[model samples]
Target: MRRAIILFVSLGLALGACDDTGATGTVDAVADVSADVSADVSADAVDTVASDAEVTGDTDAPSDTSAPADAAADSVAPVDTGPPPSCPEEAVTVYLYEDGNGASNSWYDQPLGSDDLPLSGEAVSITRPDGGVTAARDCGPGRYGFLDLPAGAYLLDVAVDGETTSHNLGRRLPRAVADGAVKLVAFGDSVPAYGPAPWFPEQLETLLAPFVTVTLSNVAIPGSQSSEWLPGGSNYVNRLAPHLADADVVVFSLGGNDLMNLASDFEVLGVEDALALLDDLDAAIVAIEANLLTIYGAVRAAAPDADVVWLVYPNYAMSDRWAQYLGDYQELAATLLASKLEGIRERMGDVAGLTLADMYGSLDKPALDAFLWDELHLNVAGHRYYAEEVFMTLGGVLVGPPTSRGVHRSIGFRP
Candidate 1:
């Protein structure tokens, strides 16, 4: 029995060493042992050997018996480090003002008492210079703001009671004065002067505030024509003189009233007399050109350092209602007026610091309907569109290369 036990133990040791060939090798060895040692040896010895084989974990054991434990030990996860990112800071605020009378009258010619009314619960959309929409908030009676904005330009569009107004905001001026501000003087007729709603100057003041402080002196006369701003005229020498010396930019839009005044008499005359009326109109245009040259001379004399921007009058007959009133004569008059204005624009460009803002093609009939409260005067929407055009023109001047001489260059009506 002792000899059998020793032999069984030796056989088990040998089988364990051969286990590397897989469970099949060990099972075959166990079967051989049972067949070879069964009859001669005691059952106790065979049982003991089988028990030892089971303990070796090589008999009928699963192929992946220790895989789960091994995988768990090797699968330790990594730890994370560092803080989360933060949001940007707010840097701009815009005020919302309401116009009392929602009529299609010249907002520019209206009294100040009718404007600057606080508006609440209006949607104000703030667009970044990158063309990303930063915020769209429901603002209270006075103001709306954009936080965490990097120092750059922005566009604000406010919608109140189905009326929308847009304004550009930024610190994009090329030159800054001693006080870090620029002085802008506007001298023209009603377009820049009167406002039941905010005019171009008022809108521009807010737009420029984010970029540089602006001292705007608007000396536009509502009922005045381009001829009224000539060298000897009080509107140019007196009313506009005091502000000219300190002016950084001088902007004006005239000649519309002059054409309208001429058109009034022609409209009263029959279409059969159109040719005779057109001759008179041509002579009137010549007079306007001469008057504008004198006005430009007076402005240059007043402020030699100031950059002059001439706003070309828009085609009022482009308005559907206005076109319907004048019929075929509207296109003829508009084309003739536009041609003359283009001449003025080219003439102004010859001056050293002078540029023209051609607004003749700025508004089509649809835009005219949206902006014009009357045949010639702009409503709130019209004023907003005008302000946008002027602001972009000024921006082109303020930031464009000095060699460009403050010329906006482009001729389209952009928003």
Candidate 2:
């Protein structure tokens, strides 16, 4: 009986334990597993949320300085003018510089101010680059004789002494302007003052319209050279002094006659004496260059502001004789030529605003053919070509007017 009571109590204890476990919660195997999974997923969800916030914050943290890097790069570009203007039709001040005294008065007229040059006479016409002419009338003396024209760009051709010169007419140059009223003084031998068909200065005036107060004055002489620009030796000084003084820009074309004259002198003296003569000639060149410097100095003194440029002779290689002469020069001529250009370059090196135009290199066969009205003097066509070359190639090289005044005078230039 004791064993039976023990066994029954044990059974009742087991049954009660089972009943209590079932009553405490209606436990399901799937329910328990789902509850455990949900708890784990909730923890994972918190971790993922924190991770996403960190990623988002990291991406946005450094975006503030990006714009500044871009801003700094754009600050250095230069300003650009979209399109250059054509000639303007208004009353313009035109300055004419002519070579020679008495009967040789070949008028080289260049227009001034922001207006178109006149074309009312047989004196002026329009020509294309390939060499064609449109007949026009002589607009009389001193009037830019054209009206009711658009403002863009045009090439003006003018005739002088039977040759034609092509001038680039535009309201303004593409380059930046140096000052308000830039004065341009054009000087040279017979060429600048005389073009074969179209007069160069008039065409030039037409070309440089609407851009500046172009005051071009020709100080070219018929028989001047690098050696002739001595203080008072050539009329160059007297004629150029005042112009230089008032000029904001000055252009000089010379050295051809010097070489031509010297070639004859060289033939007479022979090479041995030529060397000694060259030494003397070099001294003369120094004097001439010095005089030019003095003239520039005087110009600065007068204007207290001007830009100066020297256009060396155009390529004479166009001449068969010259080409042969250059060949015989061998190393010595090259040396001397290099030295001459270099010396002038060096001496003029310190001018406040100075530039040298390499007129020698730009000459081509067709161009040369057009320039030769005679063997040496430029025809109207030649002058026009020169003016075009100069306006296009040289206008950018000059620094535009001096800032300070010079105290010296060109009057004291002497050997």
Candidate 3:
């Protein structure tokens, strides 16, 4: 994975209230009063025309053509039919990525194969052509945007740790298209919604912005398990169905909490006792697998055309500690968990447009200290790593300078 040097524009207000109605009128003075305007007028032009209408007294429909010639001719200045309006500022989208691929156990998880994790809470400043500099911190997983920025050449400075990296914006900035944005919806548990700032979905959004506009809606609830998202479950087919129906892509992480919660039941038992409880553990894994398949089926049905990505839980670095507490049955527990995930992956392989994100094999034990917040949840760094893996898995190309992270392998089955 490569670190990304991306840019973004922050449109100040929520665009929900924006009127899609366009401006109407013709360039010819003798045009019919009831004639509609050309549909080519942009949204900005419509706004300008509406504002101009309010400024003048033409609140009613077009003036009567039967009016006296002098009055009709004189009305031209007030009605001021002009060329299409041009926005004074441009919108820019920025994405930042860390350079290091995540992996575990495999010697292949060398430094050359890692992704640089996203630098969260980094300071970003933009210098305008007139020598004015505006500063803002990166928000939502290395994403920052400047909306309505004055049109001109600009400079971007991102402060990573104590060092500042700069990039020139040349003379032109990317403009937002009215209908070019991609809609994405993320479902599942706490790992994806790890915190308020650097969640993986948001980071993925920032990385994909350069290629297309993105409107992401995260419907993942904290503490949610796979069962809650199954066919008759609450969140999957009910709460998030509408979003899934309209999404271009859907990403989710699950099964960890289910396994962890199940493991707790046997924590007080000795190794022999825990061994005796294997039947219960096996049943739990079977139930989880069934629920996962049910959820996958619902997602496919609801979002027929949408691409779905499933993130497998990473290897629990604290399994040894957990085993110590559970009379040394850690290996058995870990094997069962891995088996469940493998079964799910094999099942997903048969589904068209569904991909598995093998985070389980992505990070090794040595990398756990920096990534895992606990035995289960990922810290901010871990979330950043997960996001990059996802972005790469989804075919998003890093657009900045490349590093020596070796040849990145795409995770999951891409059909």
Candidate 4:
């Protein structure tokens, strides 16, 4: 059971208060777009104009014939510096991936790309560290652009149907004590490294630099599950343990794709003279938990002192249609997750050198807008929140510099 704590990295944080920007007028003007104001606006002129009269009259001779001079656009709204200084750097690439349910689609982007792809009625401009502008392309459903970016801070705005529904920006910090460098190894479904934030791993590295230099590697494949940890049929843990072997922290966020009936969960009764089959359907969950246990153990063995944090599933409380088809799964899955947390706590209670950070309950509603890039994965804001939470829980004190040998030793080593 000592392996329990070693296998899981609980890198979640208590949600902090964030300004919820659900209202349209309140959204940040697209970052850096005002720089090339003429060009971007020209591309979007048709969408921006309500009707021909509005355009012709506004651009044409004085519309003395029209309603009172439009003062709305003329009125000056103060320029917002955007979220507090806590917001991090801009994301440069987006790996557009097909949903993990066995789809054949993938696209990638790095900032400056061809203009053939149209902007999502909602696509927005990406800002660079020096305040430059680049437009993100709407390749198609499940396809977006990899924005070319300058080396500075940035934020990713989630636009749906040509409007901003959510936005996430990253945070930057300086190195903590002991030259503390945090590296993120992404493990899970197609969402994290998938489109919109394809360069998410890179984004995390940029945002967490200066204070704590962060490195992230993506190991996400289609149809990944928690059970594939180490010795399972998929053997993901084996692939992951090596990359995380030298890190100060580990991030494990999965468990969304495994809701199937298993070999261990079937039972047939009436056994007197007739042979009966035996199975525990819930056994599948138990197996999954066990798999997580293995993952926790291997990571501990590899990273030893790194805090293995778990990025839990965000709220799907708003979907009514999915509620009917997947409601039970959602509820049961949530319950199982809650229990797993408790179980991990119980199993790892004796280990003095371990930590588990839960983000599900810690994330607040206001922060949720920034955290979720979609109903499932985290966007820029969400990733920033994650970095902050990870810093606070594991890397907070290390902000100064690296000094201790224990810092280098894997958490699995006996002190």
Candidate 5:
């Protein structure tokens, strides 16, 4: 329970403050404490929405706190919306930090986007929502922009030294918005974003092109945990929420990396400490569920008309790396994890109004084996499978995939 408390206390203290200024100030205080006090906190996060224009951190909006969980669940409304409105245009600005986890959030929150120094003089390439690409020139300290570009969420790549970091960085500047276009925004972990090739969202866009003009942007980080994407988490503030204002369709793919961490932890634990590790798993689930509830609320509040796609995970049993180091307890560890995942899937199915895409249940056994890229992550073939399945399930009021293709073979992704 203390492990869960660490996460709750960090978020409650850091994000459960006032407006934007107070948010940052709370982060600074958490920093002054230590890891025990600061797990992850996004100063720019959106928790509760009083209006579309103004987003505030609602300490009572998530399930982490006992007082608000019942209220949040009871007050939940169905997802429904009319025709798209003429929203203001939006531009995004990128930021690079030498190291993350300073005043605003911990390294746990911002694995790539937190640091003390404002980064400049780096080369940035931004891919526009309509598949056009642009370059970002340094405007000032720790800031960059694309001159003469129209407002829309775009994918960004930043090269610092010799390493490349890709994400949909920065907030959307309300200059002009996409007109008569589908604003598809995605932010999550590497399941959809893993690539030397087109991502799952990109593949989905390709599948969607014949039906509608889709505008796409994805900020899927490689190693981020779900805890960091909570209402007050770093991914929420810096990577996810900023582009939500004009979103027509939003999809999320996370929880894989969090499971990877749990698996990795098992390798270092002794047989005697197995119970403690199980406790850790429970705490992690609590954090992820709380994070999801808050995230769902925030999305609904921010983009009431948007269609949400909750991309569930494929099978993790294909990867047995969790027990690779266990000499005698390999079977035990694997059994425990498999059982837990089953329960998770069932619970999600029972949850009302959650638009779940059960990628786990629908995956063909052969495809589950053939497409299990690098064990846990998916390869190109997997993305194609996901796109087709999700496309068929999308009865969303805002957008629907082409019906003629049906359950046939993928037409292949764009090069």
Candidate 6:
């Protein structure tokens, strides 16, 4: 009842406001005002004559002789600041996209991966660091742009498909044009890079396909010791180095294989040798941490501005499949995680330019068990979940369905 009352009052106020605009609502303004402006008396230009009553009265009722001077302008779209700050010049110049979904189709609902459909007329806004918001232009059916984005990173909120509320994409908008392909390079070991098909990197590419093109290069090799990707490691020069030049984003997970053999030595070497593996695990961990930092250095060296993310292995011993491989994979995974936080200061530093994604601490134990394909590798379900988290971890992903057709390039578009 209260809602109905509030709605009724709101509706009355809206109608009252519309009636006072020196113009009628959309239908009346287009119909009656167009005719009235045309019926201006032939005396002195068209705008001269007005009904005395309309001149004296405040309402939009047209004068018998002519419509008000501003009536013709009622047909015009509201003046806006033209293109958004980050909109690509090429997109605007080519005029490749259709003129938006228009007023009527603005609320059409489309699901993710529906790249075949024209970009919807979803409402978009960019909130500046200081919290000023700039709204979106209606140009869609493949085009969308924003207005007055300040010089700093801002939160982009878009109404997904036809949802009433806007969704914040957890991060700043990429500077590339809406349809431009975002290059994603995946590195490290089997945790996130497991392929054969449907790994996290691939799933991420699919999730974003409807909105933007993804150029994914998964460089993960199973049983890859982190050392293999370090400066002088076997795969460093050939597989990893060449790809970093222009990467937009890079994600990788390592550390498990580096320590697994040392951990297994605990079972084989009894007495003093076993004691050394026990007490000297710190030395190994420190070296592995250094290896990780060196690997990150290479990525930063090659693609300085790329968004780099490091995924830590989930607790593998939590799964029965992993029990046979390690002396105790669960305890070993946890020990490495805690020691990294406590003893290894380099691993525990600020986010800096590199982001560390903590899969070990974050993925719940049940998921660790359920997602495993073997002793350490994640299955398809696990891959999809990791992909979702990775997308979320790299700030936030855009909420609406991504586009199929790119403006300058014809990569992601489908029929």
Clashes of each: 11, 49, 30, 70, 8, 7
Candidate 4 lDDT score relative to the true structure: 0.35
How would you encode candidate 5's per-residue C-alpha lDDT over 290-348 as one tens digit per residue? 67777878887888766566776644432332223332433332333334544565555
Point out the worst 10-residue segment of candidate 6 by lDDT.
403-412
Q: Estimate each model's TM-score.
A: 0.52, 0.44, 0.51, 0.42, 0.50, 0.51
Residue-level lDDT of model 1, residues 1-415, one tens digit each, is 0221122223333333345445455435334433422231111110110111111111222342221222211211111111111111224444444434422111111122344365656565554433355553433445555555453444444444432111111122333422467888888888886634567677667656765678989889886888888877778678888887777777888776676566454432322243345456568767887888888887778777665777766545444545444454444334344444444544443443444444543443444444444445554444544555565544322221111111111111111
Global local distance difference test of model 3: 0.44
**What's the C-alpha lDDT at position 334 in model 6?**
35
Residue lDDT tens for model 3, 1-415: 0000000000001011121222111112112321232222111111110111111111221232122222211111101111112221324334444433422111111122225444456565655434456674333555555555533333344444321111111111112111355677888888778543567788777655655568989988877789888766667656678687677777888766675565454432232343334455457767877787778788878767565777766545223323333233333234334444445544444444455555644443333333444445554444555665565444322221221110122111111
- What digit string (tens of lDDT, one per residue) describes model 4 on residues 147-253? 33323343333232321101111111121112455566766655455433423445446545644446777676645777666643455545665676666555565
Candidate lDDT (C-alpha), each = 0.47, 0.37, 0.44, 0.35, 0.46, 0.45
* Candidate 4 worst ten-residue window by lDDT: 9-18
lDDT tens digits by residue: candidate 2, 1-415: 1221222122223333434566322213213323422222112111110111111111111242121221221211111111112322321112121211111100111112223232222344333223343343323432222343232333343243321111112112221132435456766566566423345555565446544446667667666665455445546556766575556556676655554554444332223343345455566566666666765555456555444456654334334323333343222232334335534543443343444444443443333433454444554434544454455433211110211000000000001
Best by lDDT: 1
TM-score of 5: 0.50
Using TM-score as the measure, the top candidate is: 1
Q: What C-alpha lDDT, on a 0 to 100 scale, does residue 350 get in candidate 6?
A: 30
| Superior by lDDT: candidate 3 or candidate 6 | 6
- Candidate 1 has its poorest 10 consecutive residues by lDDT at 46-55
Give me candidate 3's TM-score against the actual structure: 0.51
Report the error of model 5 at residue 219, Å.
1.3
For candidate 3, the clash count comes to 30
lDDT winner, 1 or 4: 1
Ranking by lDDT: 1, 5, 6, 3, 2, 4
TM-score of the candidate numbered 4? Answer: 0.42
